[model samples]
Target: MVFPRPRPPERSDPASCGTHRACRSCWRDPGALPQGHGRIRRYAAGADLAAQGEPPADILTLIEGWLLLSALLSDGRRQILHIVVPGDVVVPLLVGSAGFGIQAATDATVCAMPVAAATTSPTAHPAGLHVLMKAMSRNAAMAYEHLTAVGRRTARERVALLLVELYYRCRRAAIPDHAVQIPLTQGVLADALGLTAVHVNRTLKTLRADGLVAYEGGMLRILDPDRLAAAACFDVEAAGAWLGPCPPGPPTPVPPTAPMPPGASR
Candidate 1:
């Protein structure tokens, strides 16, 4: 199912909107933009940014909110291939090849430009571009890790690994690691982990029992990150150095309560 690219950002007074370091790092080069660059747009809680099998267009960077990239099987089952957060970019082709990529989840705000323009922008510094490439590679590696999690880890271990991964990513984005925040649902987690929703539920309970994590109403708290990472066979340091010094940014803030994603209880 192909969906249209999101609308271009509206022209607005630059003076009215406050600037953040993270978004600046993404679109500007030390406080300046290349000529001909477009504006950054905002997306509501359930907007669709891209669809499967569409033409390769601009490179999209999620400045805010959570996004899921998914692929569907012939049987009509959807497999969430990736989860994107602020500062993450999605292109049809990560490095080599071409095809339409689809958005698998929701609550995403995206900024995109023609791929050619994006690559040539001076503000799109070489280092920033390199970081984006590395981000894509990391996402690929994560997919492999997910495969292993479902294929080898016990149900409990899978849940632990998922929570650990989420916490780690939230930390990198500067989101509060202990905050009660979970943007995905048990069913979505099941799809990504290749488990049934019921099994995902049971495994989550097991994680709480082991003091590894806690989940309620789609919110999760990592009780023992070390133990959880160990159970998932996750080495925090293995996350490569491609992120480029975590980009100058303010800590990610928890917004006032909003509607959780579909299938999410809390």
Candidate 2:
């Protein structure tokens, strides 16, 4: 199904909005913008950003919230391919018509731009294509990590690896404290980890009992990150370097400029 892009709402500077550093980095000149650039659009929880089998249109950069790239089976079962956090980009052509769908895991804000604009001359959009390339590389690295988790690791290890991944990602994003809001239910977790929801619950319970992690009130806390990393065999620093240096301290506010592109809604 083809989706229409919505008009962006007038807003203050993109930098002031505390957008992801990846998004801010895409702008070569924060003070100037190309003519007819895309606009930002917001999606409520459960919205579909892109559907499987649809022709590719725009490239989406997540500015806020979490998104899931998933595929549905013939029997109506869904397998989540990836958890897309802020600072990530969704390029439909990468997965092509392999039946992958992009959906918001939470209320999300994204910037969509024409694929041509992003792939055209780098001189035209400046850092836009460069940042997109880096984001794509990072996504590929994450995919490889997920493959190892699902194809070889035990269920407990799978869960541990996921938590470790999120912990480091949040830290790199400078999301304040060590605690993270998982924003995923047991069912979703099961799908992502290729386990049954019951199994996911059991593994989480075991982790809690071991004082390695805590999941309560919609928050997931790593009580012993060191132990959790050991269990998952995850090296936070060695995961990938495609995600450029995370800004120290709070998110540095950028000067406001024209908005980017509009994303699709479910």
Candidate 3:
């Protein structure tokens, strides 16, 4: 079921949209876009938002919950391309072809806008173009970084880095370290990191033993913030160096309340 949800953003002057930083700034800038049409829709956990090879016909911004961009192999194996959280834009593919499909990892709500607006905004609005460029560069850098991790990183390093990535993605200035939660299972981790489920289990066990992180059921708690990345030789600083400095951004803002679609579970 889909419902109309367009609650105006109460983003008090300084706030974090908490998705992709570049896009956050784009939304805040009044001149960033011209008036556009958009509507909100909701999906249940495990629902297919976009089918494989399907080109996105609209600009979809995740309003709540989690989404996974993944590809299914001939042998029935799946590799997760990336995870989508609130304030993040969802694109099946950024270039060439979209061999992937998007699924709601949890019950999710999305705001979809006209793709034509996105295609024209950059040219009609210079600020929009700048944001688009920044987003592209960030995407490229992350793609390279992910490729490097799968090719060169150890099992522990890969798992650790993946968790750290999620931690930062969902980071909230008000949420304490222990309170930060990522609702993902080991199978999801294994798919995202290119590892066997058994290997992912052992690696997580070792991480728990080291007192760096904890995983039980489908939830994860980061026990030690300072040591989690360092424990796996995952250098967040070095990775950022390639992309240039990121000025301190405001804390991520809570998303607008979107009413659930009828028949959706709580």
Each prediction's whole-model lDDT (CA):
0.59, 0.66, 0.61
Candidate 1: tens digits of C-alpha lDDT, residues 139-253: 6777788888778988877777777676656556654433435567777788777778888877766666787655445456666767877887777666444322322334653
The alpha-carbon lDDT assigned to residue 133 of candidate 1 equals: 68
If both were scored by TM-score, which would come out higher, candidate 2 or candidate 3?
2
Model 3 Cα shift for residue 176 (angstroms) = 6.9
Find the candidate with the highest TM-score and give its number: 2
- Candidates by TM-score, descending order: 2, 3, 1
Find the 10 residues in a row with the least total lDDT in model 2: 257-266
What is the lDDT for 223 in model 3?
71
Candidate 3: clashing pairs of residues: 16-252, 16-253
Error of 1 at 222 (Å): 1.4
Query: Worst ten-residue run, lDDT, model 1?
Result: 9-18
Residue 101: error of model 3 in Å? 0.6
Error of 2 at 45 (Å): 0.9
Encode model 3's per-residue lDDT on 1-266: one tens digit a residue: 12112233222122222233434433667566534344556777887776666555655677778889888877688999877766566543444545777788888777655555656644346765565566556656766877888999999988878776665665532133223446676688789899987888778778778887544433455676458778767776776643343333345432211122122222
lDDT agreement of model 2 with the native: 0.66
Candidate 2 lDDT over 121-239, as tens digits, reads 34345555565666678778888888989999999999988876765565555445323455777778889999987887778778878988654434455677668978888776676
Q: What is candidate 1's local distance difference test score?
A: 0.59
* Residue 142 Cα positional deviation in candidate 1, in Å, after optimal superposition: 2.3
